[model samples]
Target: DANGTTWIYKPREKTAVMSRIPLLPYPMILLEKYERDAELRATGKLLPVPSNQKMNAYLKEIADICNIPKNLTTHVARHTFACLAVEYGMPIDVLAKILGHSNTNMTRHYTKFSEQLIGREMRKMNEQMFSDDVFLLNQ
Candidate 1:
């Protein structure tokens, strides 16, 4: 954030670190909207929500209302972000940095590869090498 960009910081003593990366346009816009709506400029805190357990309980209730089968929690949202980032070809090192991991090895714990992602990467590589004539095994 030293470069005049907005950043989200984790201030807990255990993980007292902040990301150096700048927010992308859409997220930055959302943050601006939240700041204005919540009048958080003075306090610099995003939300005045209750405990994490209470938040998770509310999330579960909302999930049930929405017919989501899986349990909804903060950790699940983080893992979902990691999975989608991997699937979309974000470099591991970049992802690690964005995730506030000291190293890729630590970040690897969050990455769970699926067969579909592997197949997609293989097909993409084949197509890049051989154009439309590329032939790879069925996914």
Candidate 2:
């Protein structure tokens, strides 16, 4: 559905919001197989993959098994991606584009301000403000 060439969804409703995401090299092989299977299935016009409920259930089960204290929802991955991108110093506007958000403000709502990010920003500001004074020795 991306530019009407790269098929975004594979018989599933999961929206491939990001068009230019670079997939891992090995998964390209698997993707080829999936495309072939999809072609054959489409000849008969059968439904594509089943609903996402089962996959989400599996994720929850895995989280429970692993004793993860937090609630394990499918959206957690998206949230984590946003947070990590911000932590790495990607600008809010760029992060918004990568996340397919309509505006930078929307991305801000999703990003959790971590201590590390706050500290890093504060350090940069301090260095810029005090660089000459800190380096100069006062007698």
Candidate 3:
């Protein structure tokens, strides 16, 4: 958090949500992930929890290594996630809740209305409105 906001994980307001992406769960894949997590994870946690300054420093180092011009921060990551979520058709109300926003308007502020999203939604609407079965005739 670049805004100096600190978070405490409460039972009701869970800080983390664990999910499994739909992929082939091969033993080799699982083993590799476990080994990588063991090397990278902080003690008693799934990932290293560094301070804001340290995290930003790490991001800066990574960006430098990757030759990225933009300064990457946690806010940047959150914004990117918001944009992708909207693009993927996650409801604004749902995304707002996940983003800890009080309203959908705030969520809208986080996402860009890209042409690709518009085109995809329009195509989906067309499919729902008129499909091959909708135009069938019995002779």
Candidate 4:
């Protein structure tokens, strides 16, 4: 028996790695699993999981149906997760591991610091260094 949390991600000829998906999408994942099983039962063979290209096409159709103006793709979701995870105080090293990056440098490419974050950090630095309660000592 093993933890049901992770599955290997094999991208073509690249290295396969075990990845954990956040539980926020647990319901959707369960639904997909149910549908996949049903599909297999209905047919002799299982339908392969949709490719990224097909999934993107489906996303575009969904966006059109929902009257969403922006182009929706898997990449957009990954970028959103990268930004939000960093903004929510997840450490860079931790995030790199979560993202399956071999090094922090790969994760850095995915992470973009928002202007709001920059301003917030700057304000924090300013308060810490120059607040009235803080004594500035030249060493």
Worst 10 residues of 4 by lDDT: 5-14
Which residue pairs collide, candidate 1? none
Question: What are the per-residue Cα lDDT tens digits for candidate 1 across 1-139?
Answer: 4678776555433577765656788877776667665456667666555687998899899999999999999778878888889988898899898888888997788888889989999988977877755555574
> What would the TM-score be for candidate 3 when compared with the true structure?
0.63
TM-scores for every predicted model? 0.71, 0.62, 0.63, 0.62
lDDT of 1: 0.79
lDDT per model vs. reference: 0.79, 0.72, 0.73, 0.76
* Candidates sorted by TM-score, best first: 1, 3, 2, 4
The sequence of per-residue lDDT tens digits that candidate 2 reaches over residues 9-104 is 332234545445445556566666666576656775323444568667877888899998777766787788899989999899888866776679
Give Cα distance to truth, residue 2, candidate 2, Å.
Answer: 19
TM-score of 2: 0.62
Q: List ranges where model 1 is wrong by over 4 Å.
A: 1-13, 37-39, 46-50, 128-139
**Candidate 3 residue lDDT tens string, 1-139:** 3654333343323444432222234643654565558655546553456987888899999999999999999788889989998988889888887777767898989999799999999998878766755645573
Residue 90 displacement (Å), model 3: 1.0
lDDT tens string, model 4, 1-139? Answer: 1655444333422446666544446655664676657667676443445889999999999999999999999888777788899888789999887778879998988899989888888998889878875766784
Q: Name model 4 segments beyond 4 Å from true.
A: 1-13, 21-49, 66-69, 127-134, 137-139
Using lDDT as the measure, what is the rank order of every candidate, best first? 1, 4, 3, 2
